[model samples]
Target chain A: SAVISQKPSRDICQRGTSLTIQCQVDSQVTMMFWYRQQPGQSLTLIATANQGSEATYESGFVIDKFPISRPNLTFSTLTVSNMSPEDSSIYLCSVGQGTEKLFFGSGTQLSVL
Target chain B: AQTVTQSQPEMSVQEAETVTLSCTYDTSESDYYLFWYKQPPSRQMILVIRQEAYKQQNATENRFSVNFQKAAKSFSLKISDSQLGDAAMYFCAYRRVNSGYALNFGKGTSLLVTP
Candidate 1:
């Protein structure tokens, strides 16, 4: 198991602005993923952040809207660009290391006004 | 594409009682994995249990256990002796074995526990 922490547990943002959420893991991990959970909906994968390369965005997601940076095995960041009311949701980061289990962060609640 | 389904939108259980949450998935692959995750009011997703498709026996974790029906493509979670902390949204997820693909999650079931 890994201890994951995210910055800005909850925040209110203005439309058209961008907010960057940071994810830091206690141990090194090979794969880190970002997900978005809309109100009353299931979680959707946003992107996968791997060190030393560009992040892989899912089919319905684009890097321009959710840019990710993975400088090392233990740290990653995701930025939500051009925030809108529709972007009001919970953004969670998860890490999969040597085991098949995945551990998640508490998530950052973002509300775009 | 793999899809997971949780039909029960909401359920309630009395304290010290047991409840089961149903989950079904559609997948063409023979080898895959299933998981149950719990999200409380704090919005922290925690792993409750996991089951591998190839495994014949069900997965169990203390008070939480899974009745895995591979032939039916169903994996259900049974919580025994429910507590207030057990009240939350429970999600079922599926992942491809040996693939680095992300998990496919179902719309969660909100469980309310009354003392």
Candidate 2:
């Protein structure tokens, strides 16, 4: 199992401000992903972060809103741009070595005011 | 596209009792994986158990076990000796064999374990 550390466990920001969440993995991983979960809702895939390429955004999500950076195998970041109350959700970072199971971080709880 | 379904929105069980949460999924692929994740008040998603589609034998972890019915596309989790700590929201997920590690999650079932 991979251990992931997510910074800014939580934050409250003014509307229209951008917040960046960071995820660090204890070990190098090949695949990293970002997900969003609304309060009392299921997890929604936001994007897949590739080490050296642009992230792949899922349907209903756009790169302009959630920009991702995977500088290396051990780290990745997700930025929630132009935030709004609707952008308030728990952001999760997951790492997978291959087609195996994914390990998730504690998640960053964001609240837009 | 694959979808996971957890029909029970909420369920309750007494401490030391057994409880089962139902889950069904839709997938055209023959090889895949299923997982059950528990999220407590802390909001950390914890893996409870997982089942491989090609495996006929069920998977068990301590008091957590799963009933994987491949033909029926059903995977249910059974918690034996339920404890207060078992109270949490459980999500069912599916991952295709060929697809990258992205998992499709169900709405989730809130389980309450009471003494």
Candidate 3:
């Protein structure tokens, strides 16, 4: 088990403003994953962040909108740029021990106004 | 492509009674991992149980267990002695062992526990 912490448990921001969510892990991990959970919907992968490299975005997602920064193995940040009402959702960060298991953070709930 | 299906949108179970949530999946890969995750109103995804494709025996975690059929591509979760804490949305997930990067999740089934 890993202790993952995420900041800004929740926030209400005006449209067009950007909000950056931070995720910190107790231990160093090779890869950290970000996911979004829309209202009444299942979780969707946003990107995979690796230290010293650009984040890999999943389908239907792009870096221009959700920029990720992984300065080191223990810290990563995701900025939701040019926010819109549709961007309102819960963002979560997870770290994997192996391909089989992933431990998740508490998640940050964002509501764009 | 691998897809996970949870047909039941909502289910209710009496407290202390046994309840089973159905889950089926389609995958071309031979080895993969199946999981049952519980998401309460808090929105934190918690792992309940997991089953390896190669394992013959079912996986059990305390009062939670799984009935896994590899050939049938079915993995159902059984929660015995259901409690109020069990009332939440249950998600079924699939991940290819050593191949896939993220967990592919189902639409989820909301469980309601009644006293």
Candidate 4:
């Protein structure tokens, strides 16, 4: 089991501003994942952060909008640049191996005006 | 690509009664895993149960159990003697084995427990 601590449990931001969300894991892990949950919707993978390597993003997501930084095995950060109302969602960080088991942080809820 | 589906949007159960949440998935691969997660009003996601595709026996944890029908591609969660704490949003998720991929989750079903 892994313990993840995420900051800014909830935040309200204005349009065009950027917010950086941080995730810290209790144990060292090779990969960390970021996800987004829109209002009344399920979770969608935003990107996968690998230590010392560039983050891998899923289709329909771009790095310029959601830049990720993985400095070490236990820590990572995701920045939502140029926020918009559509960007309002719950951003979560998780660490784990494949399908076995995944542990999640408390999640950062962002509401953009 | 894999997809998970949960048909019920909401369910109501009397306290101490039994209720089942339905889930189905589409996947060509034979080896995989399925899980049921619970999210309370606090929005804390909790793992309720999991079933391996290869296992024939159903997985049970105290009052929570799973009915996994591999052939039908259906995995359902059954909660016996439901409590007030059981009221929450239930999500069904699927993961492929050995792929090291992220989970595919359903839209989720909201459960309401009545007194």
Candidate 5:
């Protein structure tokens, strides 16, 4: 089991601004993923953050909009740049070991006005 | 690509009663995993139960259990003696085993426990 702490549990930001959400894990995980969830919607995978290598983003997502950095095994950060009203959503970080089950962080809620 | 579907948008159950949340998924791969996650008012996601595709028997955890139908590509979560704390949004997710891909999630079903 891994304990993930996400900072800025909830934040209200202005449009065009950027917000960086931090995720810290208690143990070294084999893989870490970032996800976004709109209000009342299912979770969407944003990117997969791996140590040493650059983050692998999913389709419809770009690095210029969402930049991710995994400095170490236990820490990672995701920045939502040039936020728009549509960018308002809850971002979550998840980690998986060898099991199929993945543990998630509490999530960071960002509201763009 | 994998996709998950949860037919019911909202469901209600009386306190201490049993409730089942239905879910179905489409995947080309034969080996995969299914999971049920709970999200409370706080919006924190929590795992409720999980089932491996190869496992023939159902998976049970405490009062929570799953009915995994591999042939039908259906996985449902059953909560026995539902409590107030059990009232929340439930999501069904699917992922391929050993694929290292992101999980595919359903829209979710909101469960409301009535007094």
Candidate 6:
């Protein structure tokens, strides 16, 4: 089991601003992912943050909008840039060890006005 | 690509009664895992139960259990002796074995437990 701490539990931002959410894991993990959960919708994978390499993003999501940084095995950050009201959602960080189950952070709830 | 579907958007159950939440998934991979996660009003996601595709026996945890029909690609959760605390939004997710472990989640089923 892994313990994850996500900062800025809730934040209100204006349009065109950027907000970076950080996730810190208790253990070193090889696979880390970022996800977005919109109101009344399911979770959608945003990207896979690879250590020391460019993050692999899912279709419909771009690096310019949701840039990710994986400095090491235990930490990663997701930045939502040029925010819009549509971008108001809960962002989650997840970690997995090999074939084990994925664990998620509490999530950062963002509200763009 | 894999997809999970929870057909029921909302369900109601009386306390101490039994209720089942249906989940179906589409996947080409033979080896994978299915999970049921519960998210209360607090917004913390908790793992309720899990079932491996290769396992024939259903997985049970206390009052929570799963009915896994691999051939039908259906996985349903059954909560017996349901308590008031069981009220929450439940999500069904899938992960392919040997994959990066990124989960494809269902839209979720909101359970309401009435006393």
Note the B-chain TM-score for every model: 0.97, 0.98, 0.98, 0.97, 0.97, 0.98
State, as a TM-score between 0 and 1, how close model 4 is to the true structure: 0.96
Report the error of model 1 at residue A12, Å: 0.6
- Better model by DockQ: candidate 5 vs candidate 6: 6
Candidate 2: TM-score?
Answer: 0.97
Candidate 5, residues A1-113, lDDT tens digits: the string is 78999998999999999999999999998789999999889999999998999999999999999999998999999999999999999999999865677888999999999
Q: Which candidate has the highest lDDT of all?
A: 1
Q: Tell how far residue B100 is off in model 4, in angstroms.
A: 1.3
lDDT of 1 by residue, A2-107 (tens): 9999998999999999999999999999999999999999999999998999999989999899999999999999999999999999999999965688889999
Q: RMSD in angstroms, all models?
A: 0.8, 1.1, 1.2, 1.3, 1.0, 1.2
TM-score of each: 0.98, 0.97, 0.96, 0.96, 0.98, 0.96
User: Candidate 3: lDDT of B57?
Assistant: 100
TM-score result, candidate 1: 0.98
Model 4 segments beyond 4 Å from truth? A97-99
Q: What is the lDDT of residue A43 in candidate 4?
A: 82
Clashing pairs in 1: none
What is candidate 5's lDDT per residue for B1-115, written digit by digit as tens? 7899999999999999999999999998888889999999888789888888989999999999999999999999999999999999999999988768478999999999999
- CAPRI-style quality class for the chain A–B interface of candidate 5: medium
What does candidate 4's lDDT look like per residue over B2-86, in tens digits?
A: 9999999999999999999999999999899898988876665677888889999998999999999999999999999999999
User: Poorest 10 consecutive residues of model 5 chain A by lDDT?
Assistant: A95-104
DockQ of each: 0.78, 0.79, 0.61, 0.57, 0.72, 0.73
**CA lDDT of B73 in candidate 3?**
95
Tell me the tens digit of each residue's lDDT in model 3 across A23-113: 9999998779999988878888899997899998889999999999999999999999999999999999988875467888989999999
Q: Residue by residue across B53-73, what tens digits does model 2's lDDT show?
A: 999999999999999999999
Minimal lDDT window, size 10, model 1 chain B: B96-105
Q: Model 1: per-residue lDDT, tens digit, B27-115?
A: 99999999999999999999999988999999999999999999899999999999999999999999998767489999999999999
lDDT of candidate 3 over B31-112, digit per residue (tens):
8899999999887889899998999999999999999999999999999999999999999999888753588889899999
Reference interface contacts recovered per candidate: 0.74, 0.63, 0.39, 0.21, 0.61, 0.61
